[model samples]
Target: MKNDDYSDVVMAALHVLEESGSLPNIERENKCEKRSDKYREEGNIAFKVGDVNRVLEFYNRALMFAPKNSRAIQLAYSNRSAILFKMGQFRACLIDVETCCKLGCPTDIESKLIKRKNEATVRSEMENLSANLLTGYFKDCFKFDFKSNTPIRCASSDIEVMKGDAFKVVAAKDIKVGTPLALEDSFVSSNSEKNVPFSCHYCHKMSEPDTM
Candidate 1:
């Protein structure tokens, strides 16, 4: 469907949510979560109104404000998958089914019956790429206190370097600790033409200006 048509449905859903005081109640606090539910309801209403595309649009909006709201995502996934399947998009339908399984969305009796009837219809069409074989340039940053002597550690990935506030480069392997880090001769001096005075341990590039 056209973008404008989707936009109109989204606006209507928002209006419904607002009228229902889903976001907030003047008399009460902590009612924002209900906003997402209201949108999901509106999505169902749109579906009944024969606006399949609008139904999808509203469901997506509801999911945005409520990422962990499995029910909303499940309904959207199931309905949209059926719609896509009707449009000859079998691959997309399988994807939705897989997503539903991952989220542990319980299938209703009707849905389970349908699944049993079409047991062999769904097939895995997703490609799995091994992370071990992938390589790419990554930009990351971190904050370090000049006075602190203790090493800072990241839990997810091995940090390549400690650069600045709120960011850090991460790698698959553990970076050798206590390894001698080389600095450009100009880095020690107050006067330097280089944009980045500090050298990165991972790429070994001096690309960012440093305070020290």
Candidate 2:
């Protein structure tokens, strides 16, 4: 219903309950439940249409209006986690997942939420691993010669190529920490998929969605 119609209906119900001497606390709880359900429904509809900002807005409202320790509150957290994960905010997603579990999410959906948590954990770990790899000193394994080849691939004279069980890039010598490694230009280039509108296609820099 439109806001005006919904307000009229709620007012009518409150009038009837007041006539019958319903307790004030009971009326407040009823109103809270109805408002929570309304916002959650709006969030779900926004999610269906991929309106991420609106979805978060409605779900936040749902959480605010939902009673503490209620299933509706848990469901609001659960739904928000889904979008957070999709948006690659793994840490935020994990926080919401834990909140859902602590709130006693419905048994039927508990396993699904756990699975999502595990996936988010893996993604989080992968990101950490990548950061560590980039932050530390990189070994200068080889020095390349500018000789041309038949296939025209970038090759180094210091290293010999051989077929093995698996491909590996091993350091030629043990290096100490805080060492400066050789800097080279990236020979290969690829643009990211347009699925992430908030990040740049070329440099992978993050920007406001409105800028897109």
- Backbone clash numbers for all candidates listed: 6, 0
Off by over 4 Å in 1: 1-33, 107-212
Error of 1 at 133 (Å): 34
Candidate 2 is scored at a TM of: 0.50
lDDT of 1 by residue, 1-212 (tens): 64546877888888999999885656633324466677778877887776666765675666565546456556655555554454334445566656666666565734652572254254322111222223221211222222222244323333345658866645536647743223123433432322222345444555321111
Once fitted onto the true fold, the runs of candidate 2 whose alpha carbons sit more than 4 angstroms away are 1-31, 137-212
Residue-level lDDT for 59 in candidate 1? 59
Q: Measured by TM-score, how close is model 1 to the native structure?
A: 0.35
Count steric clashes of candidate 1: 6
lDDT tens digits, residue span 55-107, model 2? 87787788888888888899988988887788786777788898899888899
- The prediction achieving the highest TM-score against the true structure is 2
lDDT score for candidate 1 against the true structure: 0.51
lDDT of each structure? 0.51, 0.73
